[model samples]
Target: MASPIKSYVPYSIFLIALLLRPSSLTTAADFSSSVCSGTLDPSRCFQVIKTIPGGGQAPSLESLCGTAISFSLSKGNQFHSYVQSLAASASNPKLKQVYSSCAENYDDFIGNLQSAQVMLKRQDYNGVSTMASSSMTEVDTCSDSFKEGSVADPSQLIDKNKYYYTLSLIILRISNKLGGAA
Candidate 1:
């Protein structure tokens, strides 16, 4: 038979390990809930973070925001390519013009997003917010082109456009929160 002291050895080690773990060690759900609490759409913010592997487990707001920014950048690149294809495939001159214009907007948006990544790396939260806001403006410009007198986007980029705006808005809000955290 095992002695009582020996039987408790493993449990004691477990308890000590738990105690020594840093307070910063947090579950993904907890991280997402706290990060999304003050965002424009907390549900969407949480969902976005969940899409990113290990994003919700970020130890700091800055790192989580970095994940979000990278996600947005990936989407922006995809959207740019799609818009460029739309422009190439468009038969109507006006439609072609509109898509071409949107591609330009995406170019600007992507540039801004890249700058935001740089700012986040430098811990310049304000710069991140500025660039994110610029990105939102670029999306807005792309959207506005659709409304210009029955342009009639056959590709229905508008639906995709909304997500771009929301992602940028999330980045902006998160960066602002990071500013407060600083």
Candidate 2:
């Protein structure tokens, strides 16, 4: 017959091993899926972003706008400089307007992303999360607009944004499961 203490020791070791294992190890795939789905839903984006460490703070609309303004100015200046370099440039007013509008929107999006990155660096989880969610929403809108023919040739942008968003969401979920976030 086995001694009682020896019998319990194996069970105790097994329990400890089980407890020591990271929880996220099992649900990584699920989190990846959530991020993929969230690309189409801002709410989902919010949820996913909230799970990441340094990603769950609110953002100031004013700050976002200011960033947008600066981004737009820089973008506009660069485009103007590029246009000046064109030797035989004959600008179409309509095309120029469209391009400018697109550039502005792009700048705004980039600004939002930069702000979110800063928040993340500061360990402002909530702010980063909120901004990330908003960014996801913007991407979703861009995707839908492209699909609806409201935007032209958005495939490259969609693919690029989607890939990063999905990766972040998956990483967040895994981190959460790992007890990186409460």
Candidate 3:
């Protein structure tokens, strides 16, 4: 038989190759599904925002929240920058208000997410669930209020609400996955 070192060389090389392989080999479609709740298949990014949780699906809320949190973390500064861009670019006072309100809510969502994460890490399952549920309700209320309000142009508001809703869903999903109530 060959020497022990020679015999192990192939196995070691294979292991090294596996470790060095890239993990982000997903397609745009796959990325969309993971971020946008499988509604991004048609290239309609906004469609992902319109999905509502139903059918007694407990995981829906959690999924939305988790996705939102991920999005915020990945684009927190960029989101703020966009808000500033809107504020500078929009001439309508109502539009400015809409953008400002959305920005504020985005900040609030991020804060709430941080708090929820702490609660989860502390093993405060009840607290985590309670916070997630309350936050989700707030997101719904904000979305409805913006729709009904005389914001003139509500697209920005709607987009912000969608982001918040997604985040709330993600938070709920993670909490439930950690054995907390959805």
Candidate 4:
């Protein structure tokens, strides 16, 4: 007959294994698929996130959002500066008006992104979503200023706006997955 302690040893080991198992173990590719599933352009979303600087390896959703937000903020500021420069240099009154309005709109866009970051820090996912969505809308409002055949369409701005919106959606999805935050 085996000793009582020895008889229980295997069971104890099994129990320990069960308790130590990770609750959610995911590879970078798996995380990408999960995050991109809700987006219109999942491939692009996956590609963008997978290629984040200092983030080739798997990253948690929070880190991914922070990286993407940093990029988006940089682009937003660049667009604003571009508009300001255009406004200052333009001889045409109409062009100056469009550029000035776009500069203001981009200013609001940067503010919205900043507010979204604050909300995310507070774990107020709904507030983050609202601010991010509002930021994207401001991009459209800026683009529309030139849409009456008054000025040429800025394709780069349009593309950047779409990309930022996708990032916002990813952030919203991640927040939602973290439970009831959104």
User: For candidate 1, lDDT tens digit of each residue in 36-130?
Assistant: 78776787776666776557667676777888888888878998999999999999998898899999999999999999999999999999999
Off by over 4 Å in 4: 1-24, 154-156, 179-182
lDDT of 1 at 154: 74
Leading candidate by TM-score: 1
Task: For model 3, state the Cα shift of residue 165 in Å.
Answer: 1.1
My TM-score estimates for the predictions, one after another, are: 0.78, 0.42, 0.51, 0.72
Task: Output the lDDT of residue 105, model 4.
Answer: 83
Candidate with top lDDT is 1
lDDT of 4: 0.70
lDDT per residue for candidate 3 within 1-182, as digits (tens), equals 88999999999999999889955454433433444453323334435433432312324434444444455444544665666677567778766766666566556655666677667567765566666666666656555645665665434555565655655554454456456332
lDDT of 4 by residue, 1-182 (tens): 88999999999999999889964666656666777887778888876666556444535666665665666788678878887888898777876787788789889988988887887788776777677678767777876788753776443554655655665566556656543542
**Candidate 4: residue 180 Cα off by (Å):** 4.6
Tell me the tens digit of each residue's lDDT in model 2 across 144-167. Answer: 544554445422544544633543
Clash pairs detected, candidate 1? none
lDDT of 3 at 136: 67
